[model samples]
Target: MTIEVNNESGLEIDERAVLDIARYALARMRIHPLSELSVIAVDIPAMEQLHLQWMDLPGPTDVMSFPMDELRPPSRDDEEPPPGLLGDIVLCPQVARTQGAEAPTAHSMDTELQLLTVHGVLHLLGYDHEEPDERTEMFGLQKAIVDGWRTEQGLEGPSPAPTMT
Candidate 1:
């Protein structure tokens, strides 16, 4: 997979970790090896503009996914999914930092960003949490992927569990 990260958030973040986690999530989802994805980190103002324009929300959120080809994970009996543009995941590091600070768990902004990265990946692959059942499935899968990545990286911190609220 081709995962490109552009950090324009004017904040220092582990862009490599974001890239790694996004790639890891795609791999876990069994996306095509030739699939392409873009992870862009923007400032609060830019994120707010996007939020208002795309989602019609009032403020900047942690992450927003804009899928292109609308790809889904291939079933076990199906062939590998075709290569396509998986889409863009816009991240706001400033917002993420604030969220991390507010979370019950004590963890770094990087960990929060990593979790958002995986969540964005899932959204690009047609995962959502608008409904209760959707929330359960999407958040559960997201937690599992993030925990697995953290374990593989030998990272030590809280599990970054979903808020579940």
Candidate 2:
């Protein structure tokens, strides 16, 4: 998969880690290798504007997903899946930092961003958390992906209930 990470948040962030996490999430989800994805980090103002325009929310949220082709994971009975644009994952590091500070589990800003990146990618892959069942499934998958990635990277696993806000 073509994973592009653009850091325009004006805050110092590990762009490489963001790209790696995104790639790992896509790979774990069994997405096509030729699928294209973009991860953009913007300032709070930019995020707020996007939130208002897209989600109709008042302030900047942690992350927002703008899907393009609405690609779904291929099943075992399916043939080779077609390549397509996966979509864009917009992130607000400032919001992540604030949320991280208030989160029950102590986590660094980088960790928060990583979580948000994975969550956003899941959303791009057609995951939603609006309903109780959907939230359970989405959050479960998200935690699994993140924990697996952390294990692969030799990092410590987060709390059993990592904050998803």
Candidate 3:
């Protein structure tokens, strides 16, 4: 799977770290290699505008997903995906920074952003948090994925991944 990340935000985020995070989650989840997702980092103002325009919200959000709907698996004879574009995930680094500082201590903004990318990708794969049970399931999976990354990197102590809203 190709996890293409575009850093539109001014913050200096580690691309390799983010990619590793995505790769780890994808590998863990066993997502098909033909699948792909994009992560776009944005500033506060741009996120605010997108949130307002797309979600009808006034405040900037930590992350927003514009999923491209469910994928129709290839036929028995088909060799690859019809289109690799899974959809786009827009993230606000400044908002994430503010939210992360106040959220879980082990959930750093970088870690949270990586988690958000996975969450967004899952949404693109037809996962939703409309129901409480679904929210729990998704959150559990996300936490485990992020925590796995932190653990593999030799980060000491518990790493509390971000929860879905």
Candidate 4:
């Protein structure tokens, strides 16, 4: 998969780590390797504008997903998976920092951002948590993917789990 990250939040972040997490999540979901994805980090104003415009919420949200092509992972029975544009995952670092502080998980802002990135990608992959069962399935898979990535990076394991929005 081709993951593109554009940081316009005015806050410095580990861009490579974000790309790595996106790649790992897509790979775990069995998304086609040739799929394209974009991760954009924006300032609070940008996020708030998007939130109000798209979601019609009052303030900036941590993350938002805009899917394109509505691509789904190829089934095991399928012979070849076709390449497609996955979608755009918009992230707000300022919001993420605030949410990270309040999160039950005692992780750094980077980890929180990583978690949100995974969550956004899952949304792109057709995962939703609006219902209890959906929440269980989506969050379970998210934690597994994050834990696996953290282990691979030799980082300390996660703290208390953060509630997914």
Give the best candidate by lDDT. 1
Candidate 2 colliding pairs? none
Ranking of all predicted structures according to TM-score, beginning with the best and ending with the worst: 1, 2, 4, 3
Q: What lDDT does model 4 reach?
A: 0.86
| Clash total of candidate 1 | 0
Residue 11's C-alpha lDDT in candidate 4?
97
Error of 4 at 162 (Å): 2.8
Cα TM-score per model: 0.95, 0.94, 0.83, 0.94
lDDT of 2 by residue, 1-165 (tens): 899999999999989889999999998988989999999999999999999998888988899999999997777746676789999999899988887788877677788899999999889989999899999999999999989989999997652354664
2 or 4, greater by lDDT: 2
Error of 3 at 163 (Å): 5.2
| Model 4 per-residue lDDT tens digits across residues 1-165 | 899999999999888999999998888778889999999999999999999999889888999999997777666855466789999999998887888788765566777889999999989888899999999998898899998888888888663375456
The weakest ten consecutive residues by lDDT in model 2 span 156-165
lDDT (tens digit, per residue) of candidate 1 on 106-153: 567777899899999999999999998999899989988998888889
Q: Give residue 161's error in model 3 in angstroms.
A: 4.2
- Go through the candidates in order and give the C-alpha RMSD of each one to the true structure: 1.4, 1.5, 3.5, 1.5
Model 4 scores a TM of 0.94
lDDT by residue (1-165, candidate 3, tens digit) is 888889989998877777787778766665567677778899988999999999899988888877664654344544454655667888887777776777756456776677777677666666678899988887777778777878999977655556446
> How much is the lDDT of residue 43 in candidate 3?
92
Q: How many clashes in each structure?
A: 0, 0, 0, 0
Q: Which stretches of candidate 4 lie over 4 Å from their true place?
A: 77-79
